[model samples]
Target: MSTTDVLVVGAGPAGLACAATVLEHSDLSVVVLDAGHGPGGQYWRQPAPASGPGALDGAELADLHHDRGTFVELVRRVEQGRAEGRLEIRSEQHVWSVVPDGERYAAHTVDRSGGPGREAGSTTRARAVLVATGAYDRALPFPGWDLPGVMTVGGLQALLKAGGVRAGQRVAIGGTGPFLLPVAAGLARRGSTIVGVYEANRPGGWLREGRAVVRNPAKLGEGAGYAATMLRHRVPVRTGRMIVSAHGTDRVEAVTVARLDRAGHPVPGSEQRVAVDAVGVGWGFTPQLDLAVTLGVDLTTDLAGTPVVGVDDLQRTSRPRVYAAGEVCGVGGAALAVAEGRLAAAGIVADLSAHGMPGASVARDRREVARLRAFADAILRAHPVPAGWADRLEDDTILCRCEEVRCATVRSAIDELGATDARQVKQLTRTGMGWCQGRVCGYAAALLSSGRPGPAVERLISAPVPLGALAAQPTSEPHVE
Candidate 1:
């Protein structure tokens, strides 16, 4: 078992920030683990060895922006700390399970590449654990979404950022939120023909958050910069629009885009087909609450329509010795994540001041957290997922691609089999048993099951069933009733 004063999961902005913050203490040893090859979790991308430092194509910049200052700083600090024998950074380590061990916690990881069949990796035990696993992309199913060239925006971005590859010869980037802009601009800059950008929200929504934007002048500048880049590339920005359907025989060839009515319903006569080789789509984002929820952290619904770990002023959750920061707590931008990471580190420091390294002044940390949280709330409200999105899903469309479950199966489970919840529907049809475990399809499944239109982020982010929760079940039990 490997032990440390703080075990920060994920090497992304939040994890790196937390690790950097904890590294400031000489007495407190810190260990940062990430499933990726290096630092810069989801946001940062390193150029290929053959390519120069700045040789990254346009899509690469889209990811590096999120790596920001604190993220880069964490990488530098970890390297320096390793030389000084104070910190350890473990890369390519995927944590599969985490369990509480008395007063401490044990993180069970797996060596995805290094191990034999189902081999167990080393364990990391720490008095305090900070989860910054970040989030996975949410894929809402539509007709032809399962085509070969159809991919989530994050998947394309990750391909470009991590592997230095492009999505396709021509790509249509459609989604909501600020993420789409950077992706479209990046691909366009890389000489990929970005045919269109279909966003579900109107420009007025950004103006509605004008007050919040003013609070963060740098964020405003970032938005302006992205807009300027997009305008320069002549990428069509279709606000109040959505890709109703993706059309292709074996690969994505075109998409049917439609204008949304004032209530966000699709207008009948506004459908238009746009030719594109690949389609990158997403709704927005949801917090990754698996690790936290597994630790028994309480959850709260965020304005962005995702379930997030409930954290107090200092980013401390209900569980002792556990703290959540960044997108896991809520889908705040990079700046807010940096602030929260430092604030959590301070809280941890204060708790261990006499026993270890001294923490920063409490007053300063509190003020910083409050200001960032307020800004986060404004951004969240501005980017709430559109209502009635499920109405856009076709009856025959594949909802859960991993399980090969269609909207018809989900509807039958709820309407015919009386599935009152997502779990029951999953049990009946194996809807959520895919590789993602329903991270991408949980919202659509819940909406299909409930027959109502509201945010399903809270339900999606709940803890996965513990072995104990399933241990009492009979081996030959019947399907959900």
Candidate 2:
């Protein structure tokens, strides 16, 4: 069986930081597995490999100055680690299932190369596993969210950051929180003629977060930079506003934006129709904890009422051999994720260093991680998914885009069918049973039906695998190379 001392899942800030630190301090071999073809996770998604470190234009630099140095250093660290033979990065390999066997972990992976067939199936055994799968954008369903050219604000940033793709020629960026500011600035940098920037939170809401900003001057500077970029580009940022509906024939051509009340419902006679080629919208992020959940790790509720990986001071999960960091731990940004990754690496190194290896001390790292986590918590408080935003969704609006299930069906299932939870609603109307396997529709369904976040549906595999691949594998033996 192919074995390693540590296995880091994910290639973003957290995973990169974890793998890099472990290789730097210890003599253990580590394998870094990620589904993506490239590194940097989502925050500093690198440009094409050919472009390397010389591809940043003036606008790109302005939009990404917050962690440009971190991104560059991470890339260089990965390059050096691979050269030293202490780190092996298996990119384009999707880790579907990670299970505990004896005293170690068996991570079943499928390489999405050479046709993504049964031939690429294998498992890696590791003494400890670190999950830093990061997060995805969470957008509540609106009247016309299903339309083409309607995407999350993060989607816009991903396109631009990863491949220099613009959001659209003329786009209206509307959402809550500081994330929207970055997306708008990124799209503007990519030459997208932004229609407007809409935020649902009350103006001057960050005054409540004054202490956090005071403590973290870097974070305050980043926010000011984004604001300056938008101002220089003549972008008007409207507060307490949201996109009600995106209108178009085949693609979004315009959006109906409305000033939201304190409850996040549309204000009477306060709607404006802006012509645009696309609409970018999102409220916040949901931690990608499918792997942690599948591994039976304990979950904690975040400020947004979503289940995140429960971790202690050292980023150790309920499961002893499994540690978690980054957004999977919680939707903190790149800096916090990097800090948590380093902390988790320290815990892993200390726990696994019984065989003539030196133990690691995390005292200094713990203090830094705590400070960064506090800033992240303050950011979460500053930009909550406004209460009652779902109340604005029309009864006829489609809730599950995969199944075309409408809001009325979910409401009826909850009110008329005596449904008390999301699973019951899902069974009654098939609200979350679709191609996405409830990843997209689960939160909306739960919020509309029940008050709290729904229970995690036990999933055996985090991602889809070919049926032939599993069927052809030996049931008793580890297929390791």
Candidate 3:
């Protein structure tokens, strides 16, 4: 068994910042566990060491616009911290369960390798737990989305950033938020033929956002950079437009685009069929709260109406000694995440100390967090998921890809099965029972099932746990720390 002062459940920007700050502020042993092989999570992801930054024309969006450094140097800071023996990092470990032990917590994880790879994952005990599990691309079912060439915005960017592979010869980036801009720029840099960037929200919507551009010149400059890249590549950015459907025999061959009304419904006779080899679609982001939700952390919603972990000023959750940062708190940008991480670390010190640290630069961190959150709130207000989008889904459209459950099937569960809730639909139609464990279809499945959008269902085990691991454990429940 391994032990530490804190067990951080992710290695993203927020997690890394928390670890670094804790190391600097206190004399505590820290263990950072991640499913990834390296640091940087998804936002600051780096190419494999063998590839060494790959062919990316520029650094990540964070370093490009805000940090102002090469990606290599940014990753080097954390790599160097690990080398100095300040913290322990166990990569490729997918945490599935965390149980409260006497005055500490015990976390169990699998190797993330499929098949019977459970091999009794090693246990780590810590006095405090910090969950910064990050977020995932929000996916809504549409006709032909199950086709081979349709991908998420983050998935396409990962392909380019981590493997240096252009997702397709020509691709259309369709989404409702600013993230689509960077994804399009990355694709253009990788030599993909520029087609069209379809945005469901219009510029008039952004005009209502206050100070996100004026307060942050770096953000404005970044937007300008992406605009210049699009101009150079001769790519047209279509506003107030959305991809209603994808068409192909084997893979994505073309996308059917349409201009939406102010209410986000497709305008009649305004549809156009655009030719493209692949389509990258994203509505926005969903916080990955499987681990925290299972642990009973309090839940709240963000400005975008997606659920997030509610945290105190110091990032403390309702559960004692369990802190949450980054997108798990809300889907803010990386800069906000880094600030919250550092603030959460300070909270840890004050709570753990015999005397609460006072006049200790707490007010400054709070102000910064507030400023960043305001900017983030503006971004969310500017781009929102179109209303009645679920109505556009074809009856035959598969909402649950893992189980192949269709929209009609979900409605059938409600009508025929007399199901009034998501859990009933899951039992009736297997909407969220596949290998993904409902990460992909949890929100959609619940919404279609109950006519209300909600958070992912809680499970003691976030990932698959082995029977042997279960058999060896004691029958008595461990004391809550």
Best by TM-score: 2
- State which candidate has the highest lDDT: 2
* Tens digits of per-residue lDDT for model 2, 170-197: 9898878788888888778767888899
What candidate 3 gets wrong by more than 4 Å, as runs, is 48-84, 112-120, 354-360, 415-421, 449-452, 466-481
Q: State the weakest 10-residue window (summed lDDT) of model 3.
A: 57-66
- State TM-scores per candidate: 0.87, 0.93, 0.90
Angstrom error of the Cα, residue 131, model 1: value is 1.1
Error of 2 at 329 (Å): 1.3
Quote the RMSD, in angstroms, for model 3: 3.3
Instruction: At residue 271, give the lDDT of candidate 1.
Output: 93
lDDT of 1 by residue, 50-139 (tens): 366555543445443643565556777878888888788877677765667766787766544443343334667888888888877877
lDDT ranking of the models:
2, 3, 1
lDDT of each: 0.73, 0.81, 0.79
Clashing pairs in 1: 307-457
Deviation from native of the Cα of residue 453 in model 2, angstroms: 2.7
Tens digit per residue, CA lDDT, model 3, 312-429? 9999999888999999998888878888888888888777645443445667778878888888888888887777567568889998899999989988888887887768888899
Q: How much RMSD separates candidate 2 from the native structure?
A: 3.3
* Model 1 deviation from the true structure expressed as Cα RMSD, one decimal place: 5.7
- Report the Cα lDDT for residue 163, model 1: 62
Off by over 4 Å in 2: 47-66, 115-119, 354-361, 471-481
